[model samples]
Target: MVLFQEGLRIKMKDLQNTLEDYEQVKLSCDHTAEYIKVQSNNTEKQIKEDFEKLHQFLRDEEAARISALWKEEGQKSRMMKEKIEQMVREISSLSDSIRVVKEKMGADDVSLLQNYKSTLERAQCALQNPERVSGALINVAKHLGNLKFRVWEKM
Candidate 1:
């Protein structure tokens, strides 16, 4: 019976030590969990801030592109208008020459005939020589190639 009591006392001590060790382990686990949670929160906050900065940069870039497009469009429009006006003036001058030639059809004026021939040549040359205007254009294929890479690098 005395040997059995000593064994029981040893088992109780072992149980007490186990309980204390378990509490210490649990405390350590809780601390680690809290630390992970704080780190996760910080990482989340940083990602959100980076995302906001990227969003703002994209917005500003879009605005700048739109503004530049508008300015280019206005410039092209003005150029087209000027070209049309010049064409109208040329047509008017040609029409006047045609009328004068028709009036001089029966007249035996050598100087008038030469003038009409010169005017006719001028009109033919103007018709043959057309002005070509190449307007502004966006290259989507080229831009898309570097777009993803540029954004990723920025991040």
Candidate 2:
């Protein structure tokens, strides 16, 4: 009976260790997702700023009919496009890394990564189309306001 109790204790300790390992893996995944979200936000902001600046430059009368202005604007636009492409590549690579890590943790955790993946895709899409993004944001805000009103009425 003494030896049997000792075996049971060892098994319990092993199970505890496994649970701790899984928890650590989960935490790491969560951290990675947060980092990706932050990076996406920063990239989106940069892209939107660049696009607005380019649009403003194109609209400026002073920039009109000036060859140098055209060249400068072209260069700036190219640079912004390159940066956007690089950000997209980095986002894709990070997603691949996340998938690998998830697989290492366990195939069953794939669903857990879906929200992260969806958010990343949304960020990328918004960066690609600012006008559409702005419209979508407006719609979302309107919906949120309606929901809040409904909740307040219920209360």
Candidate 3:
């Protein structure tokens, strides 16, 4: 159980860092959305950069946790179960925020953001079953990558 506990600690630290990145990205998005409302082109580019950074951070964090889970516990631990649940909740909240931001951005950018929002939601739901986390993470990563592409295209 010592290894499991150590793994859990590492996972928890990664999760905390991921959550921090998400929060920072959300804040940047909020600020950029407001700037966009006033038609600030310069701020738009900065916002896109922020989003990309957030995506990279999340991808790295997810990959680390997934690798650790697969190697150490194979997703059988109760701690892993709880961590998944927590991650789901965090992702769900982030998705909701993204949706709101999309709505504010209007119809042109709405589709891509909405797609990302839904993908995150799906990832959140997939956490309940360990077998699904890998697939869900792939989907989420794809969506986030697409989101970065779309945002950059706009800039």
Candidate 4:
């Protein structure tokens, strides 16, 4: 009966060691799970932050392009205005010359004919080649190709 008790003690100790090993494995598993959860959360936060930065970058780029477009439009408008003023001045000059010619109806035929020929030539030139003042065309799609590539690289 004492030998049986000694054998029982050895079995109990072995079971205890096995239980301790099992507890250690469970603890390690729990720690690994927690570590994975923290890493996952961190990765998600990093992705969100990157997306925010990318969105802001897009906004800034859009604003800059819009500003440039507006500036170009303003310049085009000013240039058109200047061209119109020049044309108006030219028309006024022609009108004044016509009035002078009418008043000098008794002037030499050669002088009047020469003046009319010069005026006709000027009018023809103006008609054939009009002043081309068009607004700037903002190409929004021009940057889209590079934009996709850049966004993909960020991802």
Query: Could you give candidate 3's per-residue lDDT for residues 1-155 as a string of tens digits?
Result: 99999999999999999999999999999998997877776678889999998788768766765675565554345555776897788777767766765554565656656666654454453333334434223233533457556555645
Which regions of candidate 1 fall more than 4 Å away from where they truly are? 103-130, 134-155
| Candidates sorted on lDDT, descending | 1, 4, 3, 2
RMSD for each of the candidates: 4.8, 41.8, 42.2, 6.1
RMSD of 4: 6.1
Could you arrange the candidates by TM-score from highest to lowest? 1, 4, 2, 3
Per-residue alpha-carbon lDDT of model 1 for 23-137, expressed as tens digits? 9999999999999999999999999999999899888766765676677667777888888898888778778767765666656678657677764565453454556666534
Q: What is the lDDT of residue 25 in candidate 2?
A: 100
lDDT tens readout by residue for model 2, 43-151: 9999999988766755552334345445655766676677678878867876776676555445345664665565455434333432221221123343344653554
RMSD of 2: 41.8
Between candidates 1 and 2, the lDDT winner = 1
| Per-model lDDT | 0.75, 0.64, 0.67, 0.74
> In every candidate, how many clashes are there?
0, 0, 0, 0
- Residue 140 C-alpha lDDT in model 3: 38
Displacement of residue 149 (Cα, Å) in model 3 is 44
User: What is the TM-score (0 to 1) of candidate 4?
Assistant: 0.57
